[model samples]
Target: MPEPIIEIKDLTKDYEGKRAVDHLNLNINKGEIFGLLGPNGAGKTTVILMLLGLSEPTGGSIKISGYDSTTEPLKVKKITGYLPDQVGFYENRTGLENLLYTARLNGISGKRAYESAEKLLDIVGLREAKYKKTGIYSKGMKQRLGLADVLIKEPEIIILDEPTIGIDPKGINEFLDLIRKLSKDKGITVLLSSHLLHQVQKICDRVGLFVDGRLLAEGNIDEMAEKLFNNKEIAIKAQVSNITQDLIDDLKKIEGIRKVSYSGDWLIIKSIENVTPAIAKSIIAKGGSLYQLSYEKYGLDEIYQYYFEGGVRHD
Candidate 1:
């Protein structure tokens, strides 16, 4: 385990009479990509904004690298870069110009800003079009440019909100690759908030599941699965040729095996523990040819669905 660079405790935000964030607590480790997940109206953006000190918390505290987000916001801003759901850039300004402007705002100037901006433009794959006005850039290009703009501050932490929301599949893939590369190469911590479960599953090291402003669970894929499926049965699917009723009965008789049934060429096995290898051996011994055998594991989407619908208790 790594040291936690961001520690949040009892963080809360109230919107008029409604509670947007209800006592959320989380620890984000240094150099790790942590995904903040939930449906719309779940306060995911509120948490992110509070983390960056862009919005004040109604209650509780947030410490980033020991700098209090509420009190020493300037210090927090120096090390944190935030990209909103919709990135804004001067449409008339060239991509290079936008980055340079950000650099100047951060107190970097002259050769340093220019050189740094060039490298970042190249890093984000916008070098050739660096001088072209951003108005001519596509949505993906603007997103990439926004990334370069954020990097102008040399932030230790990068926070992105729904970065791939409207991106085409190909563009989303490219952007995600760049995000992973940046984190790995720069040793920068990243906190991502998105409703896209598959995309988050592809990259997040761990995730905090949020619902109605409260964290329902915080864990990696396997850990959350264990918590949610503590007593659930495992399903195994096997495709075999020339199956027999006798073989099904034999499989059902195996201790710990809950159920056995076959449909067409697919044999479904329900068991408490993994006994696929034994099942395969038995099928082979029964003079059956095995073509495919696989056990089913819950994907993030499935696990998320189970968590919310199962009425998970927030801890």
Candidate 2:
């Protein structure tokens, strides 16, 4: 098997007395979209900076494409592209000029830079706005321009911090589609950092959750879903009469039932197995009318909560 494209061992970063990243460890395979998920101030930015060689790790090491970030920063940077959460562009420069300038900085120049600029603008949906001054462009357009700049070098790895932050609904969708295409067509490995769980859920092959400088959990969504919920949920609708607290309590006593709550006239319950039959039988046998009962499908939101509430800590 090919070696992993990105690897980190016992990574750490500190600012004065505070620890920004605490002994972090991560491995990203080639051509995979890896999500670094966490809430605000969870060391996401610190990790990205360390990975890109913008800040030196207080301890540990990082390797991109088999080149150590500490010992081989130049070679590592040559194959890496980064898009920051807040993009700052020259207001006076046109979209085409920005792309050409970036390409030139990467050793692409003259006709080659022009052609590359045009191609990247088209790829990022900025072809029509190529000549427009960035000052007058909308937030979404500026983001697209930033992406064009990042791709001008055709780097093997793309590190995006809050790639969809501040983008409108349509722009977010477009950017996501573009990322999928880049990964599939160009085979570029992506490290996406975002606070939004749903966006990570949509694009990540695997995700690592972090909190307060600690990695809480890391895995695929399906495995997380099963581990958190264990494939169990309960649904109960109003039977012949209105649902009561006593009836809810009685249903809770059934074997395998984990939690029971009321949703309007329906009783929501979660169980490990076929709980409907037992619940229905119990309700009818106890002289209470049976309205309806069925299995409930666990949602991602519910499962996500399980991780934060019950996740293992790595400190």
Full-model lDDT for every candidate? 0.89, 0.80
Candidate 1: worst-modelled 10 consecutive residues by lDDT:
306-315
Q: Which stretches of candidate 1 lie over 4 Å from their true place?
A: 235-294, 308-315
Residue-wise C-alpha lDDT for candidate 2, range 176-279, written one tens digit per residue? 88887888799999999988888888878888877777776667876655554544553344343466777778888988888777766666676777667777
Give per-model TM-scores. 0.82, 0.85
Scored by lDDT, the top model is 1
lDDT of 1 by residue, 1-315 (tens): 679999999999999999999998999999999999888778999998888888999999999999999898999999999899999789999998889999998999999999999999989899899999999999999889888888889999999999998789999999998999999999999999998888898899999889889998889988987776777667799999988998998788777799897899999887888899899989998999999999887657667775566656645
Poorest 10 consecutive residues of model 2 by lDDT? 231-240
Q: What's the distance in Å from true for residue 91, model 2?
A: 1.3
lDDT of predicted model 1: 0.89
How far residue 212's Cα lies from its native spot in candidate 1, in Å, is 1.3
Error of 2 at 187 (Å): 1.1
